[model samples]
Target: MAKYKAPLRDMRFVLNEVFEADKLWAAMPATQEVTPDLVDAILEEGAKVTENELFPLNRTGDEEGCQFSDGDVTTPAGFKDAYNLMAESGWMGLGGNPEMGGQGMPKMLTVLFEEMLYSANASFALYPALNSGAALCLDNHADEAMKEQLLPAMYEGRWLGTMCLTEPHSGTDLGLIRTKAEPNADGSYKVSGTKIFITGGEHDLCDNIIHLVLAKLPDAPAGSRGISLFMVPKFLINEDGSLGERNPAFCGSIEHKMGIKGSATCVMNFDGAQGWMIGEPNKGLACMFTMMNYERLSIGIQGLGLGEVAYQSAMDFAQERIQSRAPGGAKYPEKAADNILVHPDVRRMALNVRAFNEAGRAFASYVAMQLDTSKYHEDEATRKKAAALVALLTPVAKSYLTDRGLDCTITAQQIYGGQGYIREWGAEQYVRDARIAQIYEGTNGIQALDLMGRKVVSNNGEYLKLFAQDIQDFIESNSDNAAVQPYLEKLGASLETLMQVTGNVITRAKDNPAEVGAASQNYLDLFGLVTYAYLWARMVAVAAPKAEADTSGFYSAKVKVANYFFARILPEAAALAAQVNAGADTLMDLEEELFYGE
Candidate 1:
């Protein structure tokens, strides 16, 4: 396996330089206490933990997988100690509410650390990732007493958290779930159901496992309207804040999976498990959505982190593995043959991965910045605008990042040739791990539909206009910068194309609802491509001037990647535009019965 190293320089460049996160932090009251030195220390220590602790366990965990006997699940060796180290260091609650025991770090900084965790060991990362999501849900919906009791222990790492939503019969359709929640004599309720694919469902790493489960009450209406969220713990908590006897919830079995083997995906049986209602009755879906949104972004980061690791490993291999001589001449004449880096095809693969990874980093940071603004901005109008932007881009961030992440991982694996397929190199693991990101968190297709249906069509293109206007504003501001003029023009053209496509989709959907579904995936891709273009332009605007004056080549590399993205990658927006414009005729004309002939 290739040794994992955190990409701190690129991360710092995105955080401190590209986004000017420090300035944003200083301006926000919530983040004013987050000093530059504190951010640096967090990143440095996070890097050490991921590289030294988690990376060592990644391959071994994959090989060993998890062991389940009876209702208990045991994680792979080294996971317990590493998890403890992470929790003891307060990494689990980096973004938790400060009023609780959390460090209260901003998402902009925590996101960088999250990428490192995902890069080091995706399986190990899932544990804390789920905890963070659960914590966010509780912070938002749980009552003060519930918060006072649960948040502190979870933030302090004495407990871990899980989100239990998926059941055997239902995946994307939460309304189809069969979990049952019944009121007891006390205020607490009894939750009973079988939930599958529950990550960290029954792990042994912490003292207690808190499950934020979704179920329906007896008096509730049918379908999604009836669902309610509950907080079910593995060990019932006493009023004195101490652990009591084990609850009825048990892991019937653990799954055997393609990747992330160290993370226990289990079949949890909540046999009349004692649980407390989180929000109001029959509002469980809404409560769970708060966590789902958080998880969706986190899962997207899972792809980004794995992609970075794959790129690093591939780049390292290309520099050392000698193959056929260069097309022009032998670059390493003294050696038997030139390195693979001398080939255009090899460079193409590397650059493609680099382009996507770097853009993904920027895009994630942008979303994080919006999250910070929405939460901390003093002006109500500013907060509403930030919140709108977050809603508009959350689906894009989740779908586009994961889609490109999977592509980058595959390209990176191809760089290894036959060696990439082998387990020793760890290239294939990246591919396997990345595949889930696309499928889970409502799938890329679902994200596309949501983007088109709810965010765009339902709003009558209001959110789309807001995003386009932001891009136009940036283009106008940089119109005179000779260094970024070409980029500005390309971005401007793409933004116009996106606007036209959005209007077309809205008009067509009015006549035929299927048109929305047909154009969704392609339309989402177009939006994503243009968004990346805008970000690349911003990055180039920052780096190009510095590159021209310096010989260090750091800023020059940024310009090169930006150029490659515009020249090679951004043109895909045109093809996507063509596809979306093709309409739903071809898709709908094909009879459903023909899909599977008798």
Candidate 2:
């Protein structure tokens, strides 16, 4: 409802204290060139850009929306200006590799900036976020010629990018996609199909729109194994690296959405468009994953940022809005009513949001740090370990952050009561915005299935065990920090419960096909809470010593939230644990005739 402010100081603390990202960056040769001063400088600049440039355009952009007509789409008023400002300031390429046109900032820091961008305006954030993901795929898979041709302009925001994957009848069921790519005499492919729910699908803000469309070759295998990724630009690129003529790829129509109204979710029709294959034939999913991985984390942070802003907005309102008296007594004898802050339940709800938003920030940055380690670190073992970490945590980051994003936003909305239900209050918008985060980018349920089925159970709990060992090691080493000991202990207990539950689910599901699917959502939530609990303890341990010597109340706040998380939130895992153990019989046993009170 109110203006958003970047939580710069809190972000800085998490990066330095909880993650010690600078030290990790200093060790990585690729990131060694990045200095703390540079990270700080960029953070300062990023905060201003996100707050001043992007935040102001949020409401306006939402109201004006994107104008779509006759194969053309125009961004909302002031969006083009805000985008160009981002372009000129080099914000678009903050963490882009220096080899291309990016500033080569650490991914650790970029995650925080991306959070700010999302918090400021999620609808507006889609353009650049998708661009960055497109750039990531190109940088990794495209040959030198393609990278040389596309990276600079995209990094500079002169050209934008879109991902075309979903077909009318296919989304989660990508195996059913009907898009096709036929080989051409020019060594390019003629891509033909319709893609729905394509973000950044069409816009006049850039000189060109680069599309990463997935299509199947004629000789390819059935299902997802057949899909291939192709680059289909709206305008044919000239040999001299200039714009030629309009290509066959164009917007068929745009979907009206519940939130992120400013973003153009278009139905893209690629009709015999000349497109270059991005990766090896039939390896499209992997290539697209390069971008999906980035997008997944970016989307997760979207929820995180919105949660932070919503929580902050709610806290501000709670402190100022005078309403009912304290339940026990009249605290404000001279006033007409007491502030809502006096209500214990309201405080509990507000504190829960704070706990997740802050801890979620640490968790996200920590994962980003792992990304940098996996990519830039020279040590083979470190890279391997970090890679494993990424595989283990990516789904969690996507699902958990957004799950909490929804929960925290709801809590913030609860603080507003009736006002939150009405659109005018803006609290409802955060809830709407947060909802998609759960559904899109591989639904949270899918994320949970990935974590439990692939990451945990498939490897026979190797990643699960390794990761828990890492956290347990931290707890053992830092047991001396009295302030965080209890939370750390609870995390240790939760980890044990998770392992036991994971093993039990795998064992029980061996006999029943539906068992795993039935318990997956609850299992993921349980896993996420444990992960956050560990991050919370890590935060408290780092902040306790820092707070002991400093005058600032930041660390004290950290300690309080960690405690609150343990006392108020972590107990839900017990309920989730019980539900996960119940198996599928309760859900699947009921006959179809039972519906309609049969």
Candidate 3:
């Protein structure tokens, strides 16, 4: 595989140019202290850590995987040292609250850093990624005493965090979780149950592992409402912030997964583990979601990151591997055969990966910007709007980015021909690593359902309308610019199609609930396509004028990718709309038992 280099230029382009991140940061009081120089320094250092410490482990970690014995889990060689370096260097707390010993950087900035982390080593990245998400949950829902006791150490990397939601039987349906939390006289509860698929549940990298587990109280209501959140640590903490005896939470076993093998996916056996309740009783699902929302976006970045590494590897291979002659005769006539880069098909694959990676970066940053705004805007109305956009786009960011990440990885593998399938090339590892992003953090299918049912249908498409209005407003303002006219027109048409399809889904879903499930996936794809079109249109508007006068061709490349997206990718929205309009009859008409075919 090619050497992993952080795409600093494109990251800068998206943050400083496409999104004007500095200006947005300046407007928010919470981010006002963040200067452009500080942001650049952070990005540069983040790149260094990921490239130097994490990138080298990508292959080795996958090869060695993790070791498990008894109740102990051990990471691959060099992983412990690399993790310590990451934590000691303060990368883990880049987005943590400042008052709690964190840098409290804006999400807009950290999202880029996160992309770099995932691109370098996804398995290793999961360690701190879970910590960040866990910290966010505690910061929001945990009591003041809990935060004071845990937040500082967690931010400083003395401890790590994990989220335990899934069980052997309860996967997507949290209402069926059988974990039991019995209240004790000391105000803490004993959390007892077996939680499966818990990432970083028991690792040697940190002294203590804090688990945000979901369970039910003795007299709690039934179903999801009965579920409550708990903070179960691997080792109990004393009043002086010292570690006490080991807690009952034990890693019973680990799963042999297809990808991300270095990260311990444990089956945690909580044998009456002493735990503290977070938020109110029977509201554990809500608290868990507070972290899950953060994690969903992080997992999406996993997709974007893996796609980037795969694309770089593919581009490297295409430029060096000599194959058949070019269509218009050999570009390198002196050589026996020209490199595969000379072929249009190779270019199409490369360009497709590039197009999605760049757009995904911009889209993720845009969402991060909204996140910063929602948290620190100071104005109630602005915060509400930003929060709504975050809700509407979170599913898109998680699902579309992973779907495209998988597509890009497969395309990258295709560029290597037969060599791609071999483990020696490292290309296959990327494919395996990226596949889980779509499955976890709520499967891409679940994301579509959430997008259609909760975020859209439940609100009567109010957020969707707000989003469409933003696109329409952008089109009207830039309609006169000839360079971006085509993109604007295409985006406008796609927006209209999205609106029409959304109305159809809402109308059909009212009578038959199955319609939401049937149309959801396609509806999400359409929403994602049109959303990308809007961002690409904005990107082209910024790049066109610069391309006209620049000799570097930097801006020209941006314009070319934007053009490719509009012409080739944006058209997917039309087909998705048609599929969504096909309604539930085609899907629900078939008998359930017949699905197996006699």
Candidate 4:
């Protein structure tokens, strides 16, 4: 059995000690209520809930999986109870609107809990996370009547929620979506579409499952500009706000996926379901953006969560499993075996995973801070600046963190050797579970294109400049820290290389259309490597002085890991830069038929 432990210490160090989150919380009156003690209490409780309730069910959940009968989805053993606990404890509503009965916690804090949720059970976490996202859409774009009728119950966990954006034909290409929304007499819209890969779409976890479905109105224009969002429910509600007739939304079937077995990914058939229009017609994409940003970050953490869990399990196994003689001779000769950690190569892999996981944790928290400011800052300028930062960093958070997360999980699995490949160790499951993170939530490839096209080039690198300047400022301020100075210099050089590469790619794309797509993924990875280096530098700065005298050697370990990352990890930035220059030819060189077999 996997003994799941939330890295609350690392989380607290990143948020409270390094980021000074309490001060940021104080900066915005909306978040002024969050105090240090409150944050501590929250982390403690969250760690407990995750370990005790969710972790025990992870392997079992994956083994038993979810059951789909007719149109209903049944979660594997212990999930129903877990859902009830989440609802009753108000964990699902942390980032929800307070006006709608949610706890309305700051996003910075919410993301920490989100990480733990994924770490505990990625498959199970999708249920409440999707529910929260659906509630966010309704709270932001739905009418007052809709908010009054829907949000409280959803927030309270009596009802769950889902985002119905994907179709069988249109996944990332939302512009090609064919779902239809027909107007009705009572101001409601009749939505009819087949939405596939709908997470938490038809779960029996709650009395009702509210779906924020994206469809096109009868008079809507072509492409993405024409799409609109609708509030569709699995079970309709009566006039008194109680459960009424079952809605037209039915699960056509469920996907038999590679992993995330506890999450019921439904293929929903909405046959003229009575769905209330959200926002204005053809403006649904704007509404969905709010939820998409939320989910993108959530998905990134799924990668982080899996990576961290894999590292922990692998580390534990490495410590206990006695195998082969140590390279330097035995530390435990009397026991007739040597612990795996004595091997430098094994330790190197474990440390590498730790380095990536820690950096990812910081980057995610930093992104969450921008979201917090965007939503709650008192000044409009402050809010807008933060909003742009959120837009700029979203792709990085979604794609890069996840890509590294997959890398980290695989490396950690390698630490387990053959045991990692087998199912019983639970390490293989982590890698399987982590793999989906790269593909879904707008596949990492699409995420990179988004970063390049919208964030960098669309505004002619204005947002990119702002982001780069902020990183530069951090580097300049922390230049004097002897422990982190080397890492910072490497990070600074990578950023400069990134700037040059982006300009070349954009200029090349003007003459060659395929250049952008080819350069996209590598550019994203290149940027991510640098971003993580900066964060790791910060972590080293914060930990080194405090940890020097400790008997546990905890602080020195950080410096060593930071040194390792600077020596090994950050050097890859240059390689990514080289790959980016290879350009569209590397990707489009071969004929299309070469990729397919007759």
**What TM-score goes with each of the models?**
0.99, 0.97, 0.99, 0.97
Candidate 3 wrong stretches, greater than 4 Å: none
Model 1 lDDT tens row, 321-391: 99999999988899999999999999899999999999999999999999999999888998898899999
Compared with the true structure, model 1 gives a TM-score of 0.99
* Residue-level lDDT for 560 in candidate 1: 99
| Model with the higher TM-score, candidate 2 or 3 | 3
| Tens-place lDDT digits, model 3, residues 144-242 | 999999999999999999999999999999999999999899999999999999999998998999999999998989899899999999999999999
Ten-residue stretch with the least lDDT total in model 4: 1-10
Task: Supply candidate 4's per-residue lDDT for 267.
Answer: 93
- Taken over the whole model, the C-alpha lDDT of each candidate is 0.92, 0.87, 0.92, 0.88
Candidate 1 clashes between residue pairs 3 or more apart in a chain or in different chains: 229-284
Tens-digit lDDT string for candidate 4 (1-598): 3557998878988998778999999988888998999889989999999989999999999999989998778999899998899789988787888888888899899999999999999999988888877888888888899899998998899998889999988988898999999999998989998999999888778888889999999888999999999998877888999888888999978889889999998899999999998898899999998888889999999999998898898888988889888998888998779988999899889888998998899999999999999999899998898899999899999998788888988998898889888899998888888989998889999999998888886677878787788889988888777766777778889889989998998788889978878888988998888888878878888888888686877667777888888998888988999999888886787898899988
Q: For model 2, what is the C-alpha lDDT against the true structure?
A: 0.87
TM-score, structure 3 vs. true:
0.99
> Number of clashing residue pairs in every model?
1, 0, 1, 0
Q: Model 1 off-target regions past 4 Å? A: none
